[model samples]
Target: MTRTLEWNVHLDLSEENGTTKAEAVLDTGSEKLMGHGVARCNPQDVDIPTIGDELAASRAMKDVAGQLMRAADREMEAVGAGPTKGPLGKPYAWTDVAG
Candidate 1:
């Protein structure tokens, strides 16, 4: 069997008071996942808009990746894959779920 899929990710960035905020959205025809990130510019460091944007965007994308992994884990369990740890066998549960 062979399968092909295309997932689209959209990143949005904004800056306010030396802080850059980013939101990355991953769209899969059947579901949409979102991640958020923030980057703060140190007062002593040079203020570079591009740097902040990059940092925030990267963090947000990572967040989305994490969410995707966890989602996959949950789906795997639903399908009787049995219990398992995170990617690479590390225990992982978002703060909210862990609590």
Candidate 2:
């Protein structure tokens, strides 16, 4: 059997003098979730300074990815798929990624 799940999250980031916002959507079909982050600068607040849109967006997406991973892990546990552990045995030279 196949199953599908959907998730959505919104995050608000508050810095010393400014606030940023972001949203993420997760769909099982693509095997990956999509995230978008956004930030804005308060012109009147010099202390906050302005981080361009690109930087704010990137930061939001990164945070989304982290949240997705955690959600996946929790779901795995709930389903009794067994604890997530490293590979069965000690690593060998060939086990390295380049190998």
Best by lDDT: 1
Q: List the pairs of residues colliding in candidate 2.
A: none
Local error of candidate 1 at residue 4 (angstroms): 1.3
TM-scores, all candidates, are: 0.80, 0.37
Compared to the true structure, candidate 1 yields what TM-score?
A: 0.80
lDDT comparing candidate 2 with the true structure: 0.59
Candidate 1 lDDT over residue span 1-99, tens digit each:
999999999999999999999999999989999999999999999999999999999999999999998898788889989575555655556885858
Location of the lowest summed lDDT over 10 successive residues in candidate 1 = 84-93
Candidate 2 per-residue lDDT over residues 1-99, each given as its tens digit: 997766554443444435565555555555556576666665765544346344565677786677776787798889987455876465335558675
Query: How many clashes does each candidate structure show, in the order listed?
Result: 0, 0
